[model samples]
Target: MIVSLHSYIAFLALAVVLLAFINALNGFLTGREFQQKRDRSISLAGVAFFHLQFLIGVIVYFVSAKGFYALSEVGIGNLSSEARLLALEHPTTNLIAVALVTIGWSRHKKASSDKAKFKSVALFYGIGLVLILSRIPWSQWV
Candidate 1:
């Protein structure tokens, strides 16, 4: 059940993050003023949703047999590629991605100008989205 919830929320998380990244990139390229309602709120939503997904993912990692248990059961060296991805790569990559998103949020708040804010969000959230995309269990997700 938790794994299913995590999977479902992954869509929301990815959508929001991607939207935030695109919005920021657009704002930066067009030199638009970053509005609290349009820019800040979307970025906040992206960070908040990703954090929620990360929390659920942590729970899934602990409770799901395919997660931590796989590592313990077969040992890291014996894990099949799929098992290694679930047990290690997926969790680790997402954790880093979340950190990047969080850092982006923080940096945006500290940015002196609207362009700087947009640039910070664009760069960090974009990288985070890429990292998250790269490690997703695509075979299972589709």
Candidate 2:
């Protein structure tokens, strides 16, 4: 149940973050002012979804057989590349990715100008998106 929830939530989080990244990039390119209702909400939606994904992922990690159990069963050194990814790389990398997204959201609020805000979102969220994409268990996920 937890794993399924995590997986489904991950899709939502990824979509929302992608939208936010594109929106920020567009704003940066167009020199548009960040509106409180629309632009802010878009970014906030991304942050909210990513945070939810992280929480669900952590819960799943603790409970899923493929996560801590596999790590403990095989031990880190004994784990195959795929097992290591499930137990370590994906979780760790995604934690970092979420942190990057969070930082982007926080920094955007602190930015004095519109371009600065867009830049912050574009750089950090773009990087976060990349990291998230890289670590996803593509073969397993599908």
Candidate 3:
């Protein structure tokens, strides 16, 4: 059940991250004034989604048979590629990715100008998204 919730949350988290990244990229490229309230809200929403997803994923990792149990059964040194991806890479990489998103949102607030704010989101969130996409176990999830 927790795994299922984590899986479902992945879709929403990815969507909001993409939306926030693209929106910031557009604003940065076009030199648009970042609407203080709206822009921050969008970034915050994305950050919130990522934070929630990461926590749920951590919970699922401990509970799911495919997660910690598989890791324990095979041991880290003996894990197969699929098991390694699920038990190690996915969780580790996703955690870092979410951290990046959170940092980006926090840093954007400290930025002095609209361009800086947009750039902060574009760079951090964009890289974070790529990391997330790379680490997801597509074969299992799909």
Candidate 4:
């Protein structure tokens, strides 16, 4: 049940993060004024969802036998490439990606100009999205 919830929420979180990145990119390219309500809300939603995923992931890590237990049993070197991915690479990379998104949110908040805010969100969130995409357990997810 926890894994199912985590998987479902992960999809939503990824979607929102992508939307946030695209919105920021549009704002930057068009030189549009960043509205307090819309832009801020989108960025906040992205950050919030990412944090939620991180929390869910932590829970899943402990609860799922394939997470910590697998790593402990097999040891790092003994793990097959696929097992190592789920037990280590995926979670660690996703965590870092989420951190990047959070940092982007913080930088966007502190930005004085509309362009600066847009740039901050676009660059940081974009990188985060890429990192997350690269490390996701695609086979398991499917």
- Scored by TM-score, the top model is 1
Tens-place lDDT digits, model 2, residues 56-132: 88988889988999999989999999988899999999999999999999999999999999999988999999999
My TM-score estimates for the predictions, one after another, are 0.99, 0.97, 0.97, 0.98
Stronger candidate by TM-score (2 vs 3): 2
Off by over 4 Å in 3: none
Across 1-142, the per-residue lDDT of candidate 1 in tens digits comes to 9989999999999999999999999999999999999899999999999999999999999999999999999999999999999999999999999999999999999999999999999999999999999999999997
Better of 1 and 2 by TM-score: 1
Worst 10 residues of 1 by lDDT: 65-74
Full-model lDDT for every candidate: 0.96, 0.93, 0.92, 0.93
Error of 3 at 89 (Å): 0.3
TM-score of 1: 0.99
Candidate 3 residue-wise lDDT, 1-142, digit = tens: 8888998999999999999999999999999999978888888889999999999988888899878999989899999898899999999999889889888998998999999999999999999999999999998788
Error of 3 at 134 (Å): 0.2
1-61: candidate 4 lDDT, tens digit per residue = 9999999999999999999999999999999999989998998899999899889999999
Ranked by TM-score, the better of candidates 1 and 3 is 1
Model 4's TM-score against the true structure:
0.98
